[model samples]
Target: MLFVPLPFVNALLLALVFVFLKKSNGATATRAFLMLIALCCLQSIVLGLRWGYNVDALRFVQPLLAALLPPLAYESFRGLVDQAAPGRFRLAAAPLAALVILGLMLAAPILLDSALVLLFLAYAVALARIAWRGPDGLGLARLDEAAAAHRALWLAAFCLCLSALFDLVILFDFERSGGSHAAILVSNANIVSLLLIGLAARTAGHAQTETNTEPEPAPQTATSEDAEIVARVDALMTAQHLHRDDTLNLSRLARRAGLPARQLSQAINRVCDMNVSRYVNDFRIKDVCTLLRQDGITVTEAMYRAGFSTKSNFNREFLRVTGMTPDQWRKAESRDLEQKDRMAR
Candidate 1:
């Protein structure tokens, strides 16, 4: 009888997710997420080898992989909202820093663990700050999938923070028990953390497909700048039906409106009193309502016609905008029309 380790099972799960994402999106997904998932799978395999098979060589490799995860998580999400990434030197710095810490592990092992805890916590806080801005913060994410991306941002932050906590627990376990509990603690905690981080990164990558492009300058106006921006965006939305593009995002919408993404988001927030996702959904829901009112149009057809890609989002936005389900709205409309017709007769 062969025994398979849980970490190998976990690695298999992440591999499946990676394959699915690759097949679904091809090269469109941010490479950072793909790297993150690949690293996760590698880390899982390393863990399995070290703990399950007691591969002594992997004892040194584990911390290096641990150091890479947080930075990848940060880069994956940073790419979603921020069009400008750090310079090449800055990009090289993270790996260099990780290597420095790995070197320190040879002389002072505790320092490596402490640095990992701090690194994870720092990235967690950074992710949390971005997520605090709501879905609009994900300017590159599609309007329809922004909510999922926002949730994923929060989840990624929590996962990083949770990884920090588990490291602390492992440190205490090592101090109190000569690292007897380290295997079980790391196995269970890291498996959960890695899976969650993979899921979050995947969700974010799905919503983030836009390449960096220079945005057109917003019109310079003496007054009512927000209103002017909104008016221009509205005209674009109405004339081109930009809202009907299922892949539409704040960056794309801003580009079409000839406004910077941040400026466009802020203008919509002030003028419409809603985030970009909600404002875009407002247009989609309104279009869906019109479609629903027409004869021979099914609810699903209405949803798709109105640029809603998911039934849940379509239903949610429909209820939010119309205060009723599509069928209920249709029935109410029918009843009202019948009453009006009888009164006319």
Candidate 2:
């Protein structure tokens, strides 16, 4: 009555969801997605054997499977977030093959428990590395709404890793105390972790499809009207310093430029090669640099005068464009100014 069939039911559900996602969207065709589903299925099968068939031997399989799943899931989600082509066998095949070999070694029931624990620890370390690197090695700013969705997926993967770590701890406790409580605890933990992983898979699949299918906005063809529009917006920005307004939205900016909102959006996207927020931030960041360098304004005051609502958003956009923080920009400017001062002296 340990609800033995539950794991298989979960596995089948995961498999069905994955297949549907894969068929519906090419973007979801990622190794991470496939591997995660496979991991769930394997875990379910092993758990069913342990429960229904009284195959105590299947217990050794859990740690190895758990060890590999999180990092692979993290890596897959990372690739999806970045919109980069995922690596082939290099990413998942090597570790998966190793896990299979290790599982075979454990088949004899003579495997050293310490070795298996170490393997699990090593997998955890690898997962920690993936979490640290984040999406695309570009850090958080590069993550758009789609990338953020994938980041949330990675967070779920982290939780699964934590659950596995907890299982290892319980196993250690059982080893010392000669109790069967760890087995029950691990079974319950698996059920919970499997549910979490299923949710992550669904999210990742949705994110992939959503990101890939989103149509790119049409570019504005250069025309006399386009030039006039740019000139008008540029004049307004120069005159009113609208660039400094952090709350500057599309409608307001469109009104200032004397163009309709949709046309204004099209013009900026076509001409400037960025969205309205990014377009505004580009000028704001430039003004911030100028104020910091020429006027010796503090970053906070510069940010406010440039129209940014918050320092955090300012820093994020600044880094997105310049590939450095405002503080970094200030320091670099200071160094250059110091050099100029020395020459003057």
Candidate 3:
């Protein structure tokens, strides 16, 4: 039997995930997410070769690949919130900096290791800043999927920070243990980080399908009344049934209302006292309630017709809005109708 390295298995699993995402998402997978996953797979393979197989030559290549991961993960997530974010050239500086560090490592090997730790920590902070805005901050993600995307951003940030910690642990082990425990620590810890980053990339990939080609309008900074903004959005939702589009996002809504995404979100937040996703789901739940009261419609049908994509979300939102499950609400509504019929008779 051939001895298969654990890191090699990790790489193959990531490869499978990459293929699964490609097949499932097709063009909907953003280039950044695809690149992020591909790099993870490559890094895992390099880890396998260098540490598992004891190939000393790959030491030079591994850190350079590590340099690319954080920026790509950050870019993958930043696109969810900011449509007008800086281009890839700006992020390319990380890998270029890594290249220079790689050269410096010949004289001071710790240079590359220390830089990788700091690079991961920096991008982790960047990712956490975006996630700190909550689901509404992901203005470009579909309203139905923003929560999931937000969670993914958080996990990605945590994974980066954890990766940095793992590097630090490996550095400590080298100093204290003559690098005795380095292989186990690297194989177990780093592989898990790679898997988590891949999963986060996959979770956030769904937002890529809701692409908008229209250039985002400049945000309006005028002191327009919040009531006026709410009225405009309400009128738009009523007249155009914008809430019926599950792909509706804050950016698109802001674009339609002739307001900036942040400004619109702030208006909704202040006026409705709820996040934009919750506010929009209120409209959807209202429509679902109306449909549930009518005959010839199933709960699933009502959920889909009212712009809900998943039963779990639909049921959760329904409960939040109505204080009852869909079934309970329908039964209670039926009893009210029966009582009305009896009184009329």
Candidate 4:
């Protein structure tokens, strides 16, 4: 039967994930993903034994595991991308565990089927929205080191979507025909989902385990250490005139100051009271101010020389820093000079 190969494939993937969990460093995200893989493997084993071998003992728990798939998949996605993701639903399992015992006792297959359909539909939509936003939407590290890891998150989103579709197929098939063919179909689908989810989990595990991205060097809180970091960044910016580069960004300043990009961003936000980009623009605006006071220098030239690439951004930053438009500031300075010359006459 087509169902014969399901258990073996699931078992193999289960063993790989078990090894992954045992050998690799224990990160929360990696652990959650491993749990997802383990759940998939168990789902495969249960579905295969129930339909393939006509075993009744594991049949009752199959739908319960089905109910778990959506939330578990979403949780795994959250773990792979963000370590701070909530596992509050894991607590819901205790009550669900009690219900699982009741389902086994009563053999209420309808309840399990209904739960699986609703849960998968809701969380599948949630995962799809996350995918729509891309890797940056997942809150991954904003560094080049995480480039390879972005693909993994994309794969994770794709796998979650496919898993949702697979659940719907299984649900529809089970409702229309509770025959041997349906069992074969369901068993085969579970096996396929297991393999796909295993790939996703493995990719996610690799991203989390690998130290490719810059680790967060400091906390978000305002600490006494921020003053020291801010001072160092200020010295570097002023000494090297780094604000003259139109392409300047947080990472470059962080590198120049010998601090982590996250720490540098946080220090600027805390000590200088603005984000890294705004703080840099403030410096650029100051340069623009100096150049504006001189004769024969147009506002456009002043803005370009101050490292601004676009007129709109230069105007925005100029207004934000000085509370006046570039032209307004220039005309005001000219008026002051005229008044001084008139007094001298």
lDDT of each: 0.83, 0.60, 0.82, 0.64
Off by over 4 Å in 1: 211-223
TM-score for candidate 3, residues paired by index: 0.89
Q: Could you give candidate 3's per-residue lDDT for residues 19-90 as a string of tens digits?
A: 877876674546678778889999998998888889999888888888888888888888786657576676
Give candidate 2 regions above 4 Å deviation. Answer: 1-4, 23-28, 57-64, 81-89, 96-148, 209-345
| Full candidate order by TM-score, most accurate first | 1, 3, 4, 2
- Candidate 4, overall lDDT? 0.64
Per-residue lDDT tens digits for candidate 2, residues 1-345, read 455466667677777866765665453345466667677777867776676466887766655675566556566555542344557754664477457547656574444344445544555465455545333221212212233444555556566556657656776776788746655655556666776666666555543421211122445576677667777887788788887654344555665676665576667666777655576777888888778875657888888887775556678888988898888887887798899999999
**Over the stretch 1-345, how does candidate 1's per-residue lDDT look in tens digits?**
897878999999999888877876675566778888889999999988898888989989988898888878888888877678688855975697678778878888868889889989988998898788788877777889889999999999999999999999999998999899988988777899999888887787777768433222233442388988888888878888888898888878877887777788777777777788999999998888788778899989888878888888887888988899988988998899899999999
| Window of ten residues with lowest summed lDDT in model 3 | 211-220
Better of 2 and 3 by TM-score: 3
Model 1, position 308, has a per-residue lDDT of: 80
* Per-prediction TM-score: 0.91, 0.48, 0.89, 0.53
Clashing pairs in 2: 244-306, 244-307, 245-307, 246-307
The superposed Cα distance between candidate 1 and the true structure at residue 26, in angstroms, equals: 2.0
Q: Find the 10 residues in a row with the least total lDDT in model 1.
A: 213-222
Model 4 bad stretches (over 4 Å)? 1-4, 21-29, 85-108, 139-161, 174-177, 209-345
Per-residue error for 29 in candidate 1, Å, reads 3.3
Model 4: colliding residue pairs: none
